[model samples]
Target: MKKWKIILLLAGVAVVALQITNPARTNPPVLHDLAATNPPPAEITALLRAACYDCHSHETKWPWYARIAPSSWLVVSDVNEGREHFNFSEWPTDPELVVKRLDRINEVLDYKEMPPKKYTLLHPEARLTEAQRKFIMDWADAAGKKTEATAPPK
Candidate 1:
C-alpha cells in the first residue's frame, strides 16, 4: 500500500479506538432545582438556563455533537469542571457557601468569563447582551448582600 493509504488507515483506526474511551455524559437527578429552591425572576432564570446550565447544573442538555468521540470527551470534562465550581442543582443552604457562590458568580460575570466563547459561538442564545450582563450583576449583588446579612461575623 502507498504511504498516504497507510496514514489514512492509522487515522481511521485511531478514531475508532477513541470512540471506546469516550466519557459518559449524564444528567443525574437534580437534588435541588435552583428555580424550585430559590427562584430568581423569570428573566434571570431564562438567561441562566440558556447560558450557564449546560455545564453548571444537573440539567445539561447534551447536544448531538456531545455523543461523538473527542468532542464527547471535551464536553464531559467541561461539565464536570463547571459542576465542581458551582452546581445550582446542589445549591448550598449554608449562608457562607451561598455568599461564596454569589461572589464567584459575580466575579465571572464581571470578568466576562462565563458562557465561554466556544459555547456562545455555536449557541448564540447563550450570548449575553450588555443589558443582560447588567441585570445578572444586579441580581448577584442583591443575592450576595442578603447572604452576607445572614452570615455570622467573621
Candidate 2:
C-alpha cells in the first residue's frame, strides 16, 4: 500500500509539472538574412543549419521531447551559452571578433564539441561528417590566415 501511494504521488506530480511547464509554448528565434556581411554560401549554410544553428544562431528549432521539463531547461541553457560564445547573427568583420571566431571554430571543430552529442542524438543529420569538418577547417584556415598579420604572436 505504501509503494502504491508513492507511485500515485509521483504520477500526480508528473501531470502537474507538464501542465505548468508547457514547453511547447516556446518559440525559436529568427534567422536574419546576412547577405550584406558576406554570409556563407548555400552549401555551408546548409551544413551550419544542420550542425550549428540549433545552439549557435538566431534560429533554434526545438524538438517535441525537448519541450519536456528537465530536458527543456538543458536545451535552453545550452543555446543560451552557445549564443554567449558567438552569435552568428552579429559576427563582426573586425579583426578582434574574427580572431575569436577563428579560435572558437577550431576549438569546437577539432574537439567535435560544438553540437553536443545530446543534440545529434535526436538530430542525426546534425552529426558532422569528415567532409563537413574539412570544409569548416578550410574556411577557418583562410580566416585565421587573413587575420595573422595583425594578430598577436602565439
Candidate 3:
C-alpha cells in the first residue's frame, strides 16, 4: 500500500509537470468566412457551425478539457489538423478550389467520416442526425456543381 501511494504521487507530479508542454490554443481572425463567401442556407450554416466549426474553423470554442495536459495535446493537434484540411474561416477564393472543397465535404459526409467519432464522443452536441447529414450532403453536392460550372476553363 505504501509503495502504491508513492507511485500515485509520482504519477500526479508528472502530470502536473506536463502542463508546461501544452500547445498554444489560438483562434485566428476570420478573414473570409464560408458564409460570407459561399453563403449556405441558414439551416445548413447552423448545422455546419454546430457540428464542424470547433476544429474546422478559426472560431474554435476551447472547452474546459482543452486547458488540461494530455487532453489539451490531443485537442490542439486535432484542431490544427482539421483547420489544415478544411478551414471554413479561410474559404478559398478560386472557383476550382471551392469546387474541390465542396466535393471533399460531400465525400466525407457520404462516408459518414466527419465530425469524427472521437470528437462526437466528447461533444455530443456535434453529432448529426441522418436528416442533418443528408441536408449537408445535398447542399455540398449542389454547391460543388455550381462552383464547377462557374470555374474558368483550365
TM agreement with the true structure for every prediction: 0.87, 0.75, 0.91
Q: Kindly give the stretch of ten consecutive residues in candidate 3 with the minimal lDDT sum.
A: 143-152
List the candidate 2 regions with Cα displacement exceeding 4 Å. 1-10, 18-35, 146-154
Q: Name the 10 consecutive residues with the lowest summed lDDT in model 2.
A: 29-38
lDDT of 3 by residue, 4-107 (tens): 99999999999999999899999999989987758999999999998999999999999988999989999999999999989999999898888889888888
Q: How many residue pairs clash in each candidate?
A: 0, 0, 0
Q: Across residues 81-137, which tens digit of lDDT does each residue of candidate 1 receive? A: 999888999988777777787788888989999889999998999999989988988
The top-ranked prediction according to lDDT is 3
- Which of the two candidates, 1 or 3, achieves a greater lDDT against the reference? 3
- The lDDT of each candidate is 0.88, 0.72, 0.92
Q: What is the C-alpha RMSD of each candidate to the true structure, in Å?
A: 2.4, 4.4, 1.8
Pairs of colliding residues, candidate 3: none
**Deviation from truth (RMSD, Å), model 3:** 1.8
Candidate 2 backbone clash number:
0
- How far does residue 7 in candidate 1 sit from its true spot (Å)? 5.6
For model 2, state the Cα shift of residue 45 in Å. Answer: 1.3
Per-residue lDDT tens digits for candidate 2, residues 84-137, read 777776566566667677778878888888678877888899988888987977
Supply candidate 3's per-residue lDDT for 136. 94
